[model samples]
Target: MAPKFGTSGLRGLVTELTADLITDYTRAFLEACPTGGTVHVGWDLRPSSPAISEMVIAAIRAAGIAAVREGALPTPALALSAMEAGHAAIMVTGSHIPADRNGLKFYVPGGEITKEDEREILMRLGQDWEIALRPGALTEGTQSAENYIARYVSGFGTDALAGMRIGIYEHSSVARDILIATVQQLGAQPVPLARSDTFIPVDTEAVDPATRTRLATWCAEHALDALISTDGDADRPMVTDGTGQIVPGDVLGALTAQALGAQILCTPISSNTMIDAMPEFARIERTKIGSPFVIAAMESALLADPQAKVVGFEPNGGFLLGFTAQGPAGPIAPLATRDCLLPILAPLTAAARAGISLSELVERLPARFTAADRLAEIPTDRSAALIEALASDPAQCAGFFDTLGKAEEMDRTDGLRLRFASGEIVHLRPSGNAPECRCYAEADSPERARALVEIHLGKLRDRLG
Candidate 1:
């Protein structure tokens, strides 16, 4: 398929993202969202990202907009720079996808492009456009990375992580060095582990078994108090406790929200239902499964009460701050974009203040275990048809979930989500960035939740066959 807009950005295979296509999309973005004199551009560690960045920069210059290249930075860092500078930005990254695939995330001066902005870009695509007679200037900058690191250090305090030995899984993430720097500035001993030269697609939400085992082994071998990492672009975070036990992203979101004293919270429906059980937030809002949806909800909350301390997060541990919050050191300016560092540092500092381990911090939350996995290469049409069949035919739905339990409730917010009589939830949706059908299950026990995901995805694969 051609490069198309997904949940948060434009994504497609590397081979399909030709120079002409990339330039056209950039031009369309420029037309769709006219900016000031400049546009910020950045990229990730993927092999194709540099060439893609070149295309984006060329397109920006052609439109008479100076291009400020913040090379090899995380998506949030780039967005933060552009937003603060009051300019539009584009990031060439595939996020957690494999090396063969890549994507481009667009941002306006306010924050990430909304669905309406996406529609405008789509409407302007492939149209003839005028180029400036004089190409705009091109320059480079490194302040984005430095500013990003300072964000965590100043917000969490210098000694937030003192006396803690943290492990950094430097697995080709664009933010590896920045993570190490931030940890050190917070007075933690960072042990760099598994630094990779090649890009490794590490999905924080659905970590593979091999990576899980590796995390545990590394934690024990290095005598680490906590382990931290991110995906290719470092927007989604992967954090583990002393025992290398992965903390669920939604759980991390709850902890971080409570730590920051947020009054309002917004998250997707795919997240663990246990969030509703948390009493820290005065109000909670659930939306469709994506950052854009959660962000929109957060904006509404802010509109209703501009002084409300609002926060948004995805199930992948990408946290968003909607208002300036008072931190241990001082004030943390709001950055209404998906971020990895805030979620990671907030939980660590909260646990430290409580004199408890990360695992113990998680144990204090409600016992709602969530597990997710995706069936690779399942076409979107096939997944949509399966969901439609099950939704329309009661008998088929019952037969499909025969061994599980009766379907007590169904939520079609973004996909097909069924609440069984036993309170277990099974949600199926086609991945926005790839040709995969994803299954998310939540149960009272971790083992049961994992089994539900495995069994449901197996059935999906068989049905596709």
Candidate 2:
């Protein structure tokens, strides 16, 4: 079966994510865009990345365009470089999914492609992938990593985090070295922890129990000020406070917005509800979950209020700065893509300035907590059927949430998000990147939010079984 595009990119099983497939899609993407000149390609630390990237680079050259290789780097780094050079880019990554899976993210001359662009590429794609062809030696891309670090270095200044001691859990992330270097450049004492060559899928949004325990252990062992890490491609940030406890991504988004003093903020419906009540942000827009949706909404917001400070973030801690934000160090250039660095720096800086720990800063926010998990081995059709059953009939919706509480209201933004009479939320959606159904819950306390996720996931499991 042909791999399909997800929220941010194309993801599928490694068996089906073949070189021929990559080559075929790369050719189709080039055919779909007239602005193609020099294409920039990068990949993650996955074992399959180099081969997939080679296939894509060869296809770019085969299409009569120059393929400037950016080598192994963070997804956002490649995107930042591509945007600066006005060149299209492709990233070989699987994000936070398991190692058995791999995927690709494409960027046009401007940034991530929109839904229309995805449709165009899909329409252009052929039924069968081409036979493997000899890959041509490509030219090395310019100093994109350096340029990306420079953005933060200039924005936050040297040693801005002078008094902070951060631990970087480098468990085979592509940006392991780059992240450590950036922290050092910013004058923060960084402890490199959990360095591994094997690719590890570290989901920031729904962290695993084993990883959580490890983080806590690391924090206790080293007395860290914070622990920072990212997903496979290093676009989504997973941050831990001094005690090695995590701060939910949506809460981090709020703090980052506060730090940026953003006038217009765009997020997804699945984000924390505090955004709705936040008065500091004059304009708050919630889009369907996905960077593309948020990016488009940001475009509309900027067009309406050109001079207003605009920014977008997701519950995954992937931030997009619609405008260059001025900070103590300097003015940072806008990287209107899912970026991990900005979310990390903006919040850490805010806490440092206030002389508070990261956890303390998080607690100061309105009491709203979120927990997420997925029911694995569930097909997309099955997951959609579940939502359709509830959405098509009010009784189904009411009965589905009846055990927990009355379904006070229902929201179908990107999925089925039902608000309970007990001031709790349960959102269920099919995983875009994997064969699973994701469930999210939010409540007044962390324990309650976690319990809701566990309860609802059990419900889904029983129904599917």
How do all models score by TM-score? 0.98, 0.96
TM match of model 2 to true structure: 0.96
Model 2 scores a C-alpha lDDT of 0.86
Best-fitting candidate, measured by lDDT? Answer: 1
Q: Which ten residues in a row have the lowest lDDT in candidate 1?
A: 1-10
Q: Give per-residue CA lDDT, model 2, range 146-177, as digits (tens).
A: 99889899998896788788999999888888
Q: Over 4 Å off in model 1, which ranges?
A: none
Candidate 2 stretches with Cα past 4 Å from truth are 34-36, 127-137
Cα lDDT tens digits for candidate 1, 223-289: 9999999999998999999999998788888888988999889999898888788787789899998
Candidate 1 yields a Cα-based lDDT of 0.90
List lDDT for all candidates, in order: 0.90, 0.86
Q: Best by TM-score, which number?
A: 1
